[model samples]
Target: MHESFRLRVVETKMSKMSKEMIHLLGNYGHIGFTFVAAIFIGMGGGIYLDQKVFDGRTAPWFTFIGLAFGIAAGFKSLFDIIKHQNKEFEDKD
Candidate 1:
């Protein structure tokens, strides 16, 4: 009877852990997409400027600037998401 009770306790803990893992993954998926989209948009804008305004002479310069902007935007977005999540958890508590 004691061994059976211990086994049940372990099973319960495992199920709870699995649920938490799934929830974490779902949050990560949203953040991942946001980061990718921000980067692409920034880079695309830079490429367009370089091609139309710079006449392709400064092709790579604009592209590099766009990439930097994209990286910064992505990190800012990630931080915002994390801050929001933290606030949510705090409210729940």
Candidate 2:
């Protein structure tokens, strides 16, 4: 008598996620994580600039320019993300 055990190499298909889905999820996750990270970084930078350039030093009224630029960049990134999401949805449809 020969006895054999069924080996599951790929597990159950129902429990596995597609590579595309995983990749998309990873992209969105990184975007969200980076957005959060950039917020913290921007806040730190803004505070540093406020203290070092605007509060303590007698400089031009351009100290907050960098902060404004950083905020604009963040908003631009958000706009790009929304555009990309819309394009993806259109493509899927």
Candidate 3:
């Protein structure tokens, strides 16, 4: 009976830890996806403007601007996620 009780307790703890780990992984995946998505969207917009609107006259200039914007947007998203996570942790405490 004593051994069985201890085994059950250990199993419960392992299950809980596994769930938490999965949740953490999901959060990280979301953050990475959002960051990359923002960058790609920004770059795509810039490309559209340069090629379609300017007829390629703007060429690399618009592309560079767009790339810069994309990078900035990515960083902004990363920071925002970090802040949100920090807030959640604080609330839990």
Candidate 1: residue 9 lDDT (0-100): 99
lDDT of 3: 0.87
Model 2, range 30-66, lDDT digits (tens) per residue? Answer: 6766666656666667666667756846343334554
Which lDDT tens digits does candidate 3 get at residues 32-59?
A: 7888898898899899999999999989
* Candidate whose TM-score is highest: 3
For model 1, what is the alpha-carbon lDDT of residue 13? 93
Q: List, residue by residue over 30-79, the lDDT tens digit for candidate 1.
A: 99899999999889989988999888999899988998899899999999
The TM-score measured for candidate 2 stands at: 0.49
* Ranking of all candidate structures by their lDDT, best first: 1, 3, 2
lDDT score, candidate 2, position 74? 72
Worst 10-residue lDDT window for candidate 2 reads 1-10
Off by over 4 Å in 2: 1-24, 36-60
Number of the candidate with higher lDDT, 1 or 3: 1
lDDT, candidates in the order shown = 0.89, 0.62, 0.87
| lDDT score for residue 24 of model 2 | 71
Stretches > 4 Å off in candidate 1: 1-26
